[model samples]
Target: MNEDSLQHPKLERQPMEPRALKSIILSTITIVCAVTACIPLFSVLIMLLYRGGKRLTFQLFYTLPPGAFDAPGVGGFGHAILGTAFMVGIAGLISVPFGILAAIYLAELGPHHKVSEIARFCAKTMTGLPSIIAGVFAYAMVVLLMGHYSAWAGGIALSLLMIPTVMLTAEEAIKMVPNPMREAAYGMGCTPTQSLIKIILPVAMPSIITGVVLAVARAAGETAPLLFTALFSESWLAPNNPTASLAVLIYNWSSSPYQNLIELAWAASLILVVLVFFLNIISRAVGGKTKL
Candidate 1:
């Protein structure tokens, strides 16, 4: 046989089939559909940045809203900004410990146990529950009992929202820690709690931090729950006896008749987006480093 014919057998030189071409075409279509779904979110963000760009000034960060019928570029969201931070901080304080403990229980004790199974079910249910429902629950349980809306009430609501996120992320983080590490700690005469705190937790800190960051971001943007529980304020600053938050302010301004208030709303939104974006970036960087 000729060398050329021997080198390239008939089967080896076969052309690409129509079925393979169809599979490629279908995969391309699936990718296009996925990209198309993201367009609306991109468009909304673009519109917000464009409309709110002119009002994004230092004064917006420094001053409070002037009032109704005021011009586009007036007052800032300082009070709201401070309020959001305080509320979210309190929420984090409330959620993080519980979440970490729950995660540890799930990971260390094994999820196959009845208690772990129940905990997992509860977490899943809480995760799927509506934000408004959480708000209502807080209002009924905390606000009504307290006789009015308070920062504490808002913090509790945010904590409820945060717990599931933290728990799930923490569980995943704990699981990510290699089993050999735990075994090694045990081999060295470390107690279960000691191994968890000294070895597993330190190793999983990055993932836990990432989860906390994400939970904080979500809690920061929550409006519906804050509405029923936190309520809104124009005069009283958050961290006051009773707190007010950025989400409440945004909700109030966006629904107001005044263009100035609406503009302030947009500016507040820009601030929130920037804050959350930076948080996510930090979380990713830390997670990546720890992963390495």
Candidate 2:
């Protein structure tokens, strides 16, 4: 051996050090657990495809539901699809502004104020509020007052379900804005309102949008609330009339004695799943663009 090598001897390499072995063991366990968890999700997706895919036809998008006593497979739930869109649109209009404004107040304007604290507490409490309760509230507040089961009541019911989700998520997004941005805005003599509008809000907008999309997805899948407020209809959507939504359709048809109606329920279930999946994808995509 050379003199230098003899003076500075190299240690023998281990095939597997204890830490490395432990890491490998944990990684294997994690992967196995992750894969096991995904099995049920994949199984459900496969089942949906098998059962619902067969009924997906052009007519399914354009025709009304078949009569309960009519021939099998003669009609579709186009009205329900339209009603779902209308009520969700109305819910978005009602909730998005209120939720974002509440978030702004919580995260910026008066985060420590007593009123803010009360508002925050109310929002958190609402997050856990059951869909059935929201439905009941809408029924009592809107349906009874309006003296009818109309699309307006349904939209109001869905808006209640959406607001808490949007507000909490938006507050988190706003709070994530770097303090340096706020400081710099102040250093430039910008008012708090100006800074919020020009800097903080712009930076936080992507995440806010993500939250809105997620809230919409959740609202779209709600059945209990729509059942109480919108009820169900056999005709196309009307603002002053009972509405049909995919969730309600699925609930109403799933227990039917008719095989065709049961199949329609499966199709509606598949559509609702796909809609929620796409909304989630959109949320993730928008969230990826958040400045902070």
Best by lDDT: 2
User: How far out, in Å, is residue 86 in model 2?
Assistant: 1.0
Candidate 2 has a TM-score of 0.91
Q: Write candidate 1's Cα lDDT for 1-292 as tens digits.
A: 8999889877642236787778888999999999999999899889879977768898877677686656657677787787788788889999999999999999887768999999988998998889999999999999998888877788899999999999999999999998889899999999998999899999999999999998998999999888887787665464424666777887788988888888888888888888888989988987886751
* Model 1, C-alpha of 16: deviation from truth (Å): 5.6
Tell me the TM-score of model 1. Answer: 0.90
CA shift of 113, model 2, Å:
1.1
lDDT of 1 at 279: 89
Candidate 2 residue 281 Cα shift, in angstroms, is: 0.6
Expressed as tens digits, the lDDT of each residue in 102-172 for candidate 2 is 99999998999999999989999999999999999999999999999999999999999999999999999
lDDT by candidate, in order shown: 0.85, 0.93
**Model 1 weakest 10-residue run by lDDT:** 235-244
In model 2, where do residues sit more than 4 Å from their true spots? 1-25
